[model samples]
Target: MAFASVPNGNNIRNEDKVNEFLQNKSKSMAKVYLYMGIGLLVTALVSLGVGALFAGLFSNFNRVDTAYIAENALVAYITTMVISFIVLLVDGVVIARRAYSSKRSLWVPYIIYAVTMGVFLSTFLIAGIDFYTIGEAFGISGLAFFAMALIGYKSKANLNVLGMVASGFLFCLLIGSLFWGIFYLISPTLVYIFDIVASFAIMAFIMVMVAVDTYNIKRILANGCEGNVVLYCAFIMYSDFIAVFIRILYLLSALKDK
Candidate 1:
């Protein structure tokens, strides 16, 4: 008589593990996206409300018709911005890292950072960038973000190498762009070229990072990272989205000029 084959115990256990991972995957992603979405909302509201007041006060300086006035104001503005950027970078890095250490850190510091960033973004009005262009860039950014994020989440390839390389490139690009930007008054023509190049470079870097970050977040959840780490991941994705959004804004501004 032929005996019925028994189910392999190891295979059954492995199958169960996969099902558990798939089930928990949705919940993990929901938590991350929820935090990121709220952060974006806060930033948007802050930028819009604060931007209006800033635009009115600085309207005379940003008038493109008067080269002398605009260039002078822009030089000073760039210098101030460089300083602000440094402070924001340092503060954001310091606070964001703490999310791993303290649960309370996931809330207040992140909000403060988002609000401050919004205030910084509002200063873009001094460059004569309109809300329409901002909105258009934001729309493009959202689309790109979702596409890359989806690809990253579904992909099985390890993106750790790409993430590391992209981080280095981003740091170098930041320094190069800021250094070049500070000289805009001296050579507007050259600055335009550098701006175009930098915009494209930054956009490419941000795209790769978005995919890498998304993949890593899913992988981390699979390995069972703590709840607070989920907030940190959201903060990272929030930063990636902002980077892409700001780069899109730059490209839009450049195209509009032409």
Candidate 2:
């Protein structure tokens, strides 16, 4: 989504004036990290709950053996995707409405959605997914997140052009991955290749997004377009962070299988 314009007209008439933009940009970035933390916490709690639920459901009968466990795990994973998509749709609508009506309040739904994602991630965590793999995923993703946010906040380079290009690549990557996963069944070999490629590309994209989004936030503030720019920045940060985290998880899990 494009940054909201100020009533005065142009967003950032002077992008070179770092002093004028620093304070607000810092605040906006801070808000983003806050939301990221909250989202992570909610995800952990919810995912553990989901795991406990599944474990309980499966423990009752010898008739339901490991095959049943495997089947249930697959079903649960699919269920998570559907739920996440639906929630994301709702989040988009909420964000749009807030953008028009009450922009500052947009963070509310965002936090809720973050919690929902926590639940989604927990699914894999609970299914006997390796803790080391999860830790590695978070480690790589966290570093990536900070690096991107830092570059976006500190760098003077116009990442906007790179952002657009990276976005296109990311979209294509997703489509290609889906097709490969479904058609070729994404064998372990294929999964590894895709995971490595996706991690590198996504890391690049996330860095670009951080720069572009940070620039946009500064522009919004510079233009005097108030009302929760913090929330908007937070949203962007959370999205980048989560994507990186998930991608890292995918890469690590594929490697673990080998």
Candidate 3:
């Protein structure tokens, strides 16, 4: 994705301005990545701790009594997911009002969101995915994220148009999935297929979002926007990274089961 127009009408002919712009962009991007990394670390640690604490619940169930385990686990997972969703809503609100909110208020919701997500993600351990495979998926997700961010940073392409299109498509996908969930009992196999397709589609959408969001961040910085907006930017990128990681994990788990 390449655009012919230079952002902010930057004078590429002026050597000093060009250097200054590059330096500032680098510093801004570094902060974005640093915050994102911290968020990821927090999520990973909390997830691991939760998984360890609930190891007994996730293990040693007899195949003969599988029905009981499945029933209880499903209920627990669904409850956790609902709570996580609420946390996400609150987190979004915090991000939206971040400029006006105190630093403590902003940090509280962000931390809560990360911790809630970690608890939710620990449900994956119940699926019996080995640690090695889980680590591999994380590695792949990191590489994919880095590659997309680099492209977004270096590419001259305008992503505004693409972002709008992708957002619409994503909305449709969410609607379709909701309907699928409601009607899945009618055709479990077909719904499963759709779920797989939806997972991959979501992965692609989020990957594009990562690039678009990164480009937008750079554009904001280029325009001389300042303050604690970097926190909001990191939240956006961290969400993208987690989405991609979970999708890749789902794909890998599916393949492993096969």
Candidate 4:
């Protein structure tokens, strides 16, 4: 008599373990994204609040007293930007160096980073980027972030090389900026061309870094890191998103000027 083949019980158990791990992984990823969203919301609120405060310094939003503020406004604006930028740098260092000690330790620096970054980013308005263009750039940034993140999540190919690529681009941008200033002294037209190329390079760098960060997030969980590490991953994602938003906003402003 011929025997009927049946599924092995051990194989069935292994499949069940795989499914359970996938479910847990999904939940963990959701939590990390939730943290990212919260950080972004904090940044948005701080940005709008600081922007209004700055406008109020000029009198009121309904009727900005251009004449009243003309003389002192530039000085105050530059001062605020300078101060916030310093705080931002300090907070970034704290997050990178100390926040990894524990879950509780991360919150203060994370929130401070969000707030300072908001204050710093709002200075763009003082430089004349309008809310409408900001909104447009934000929408585009959201789309690009989601698409790149999805690609990173689905891709089986290792993206570790992207980190090196991003670093090389960053070094080039720094060197390019130094040349930009020097070339500007010689030719204003050359500076303008540098501005365009540098913008494109920065945008490219941000996209690659975003992919690397997203892939890193997956690796973090796969390697059995604790929950705090997941939140740290969220912080990394938040930075990537904000970086892309800034570059996109700048590009939009540049295009509008053109």
- Runs of candidate 2 exceeding 4 Å displacement: 1-21, 61-84, 168-199, 223-227
> TM-scores of the models, in the given order?
0.74, 0.70, 0.76, 0.84
The alpha-carbon lDDT assigned to residue 91 of candidate 4 equals 77
Runs of candidate 4 with Cα error greater than 4 angstroms are 1-5, 60-80, 98-100, 181-188
1-258 per-residue lDDT for model 2 (tens digits):
899866542335555466566765556556656766776777677777877776565554456545677677667767877888799789867765675455257767876787677666766766677777788888887887777667766667776887889899999999887766554463667776776787788767766776687666655555544455556656666677777788778767766787
Candidate 3 per-residue C-alpha lDDT over 44-76 given as tens digits, one digit per residue, 9 for 90 to 100: 888888777556554535465665675576567
lDDT of each: 0.81, 0.70, 0.78, 0.81
Residue-level lDDT tens digits of model 4 in 134-163: 999999999999888887887788887877
1-258, model 1: which lDDT tens digit per residue? 999998899999999999998878778888899999998999888877767754554566556575566556556656756776786787687766786675465677677768767767876765678879988998999999999999899988888788888889878877877777566877888887876777787788889989999998898888766667878888889999999998889888878988
Which residue pairs in model 1 clash with each other?
Answer: none
Worst 10 residues of 2 by lDDT: 7-16
Candidate 3 overall lDDT versus native? 0.78
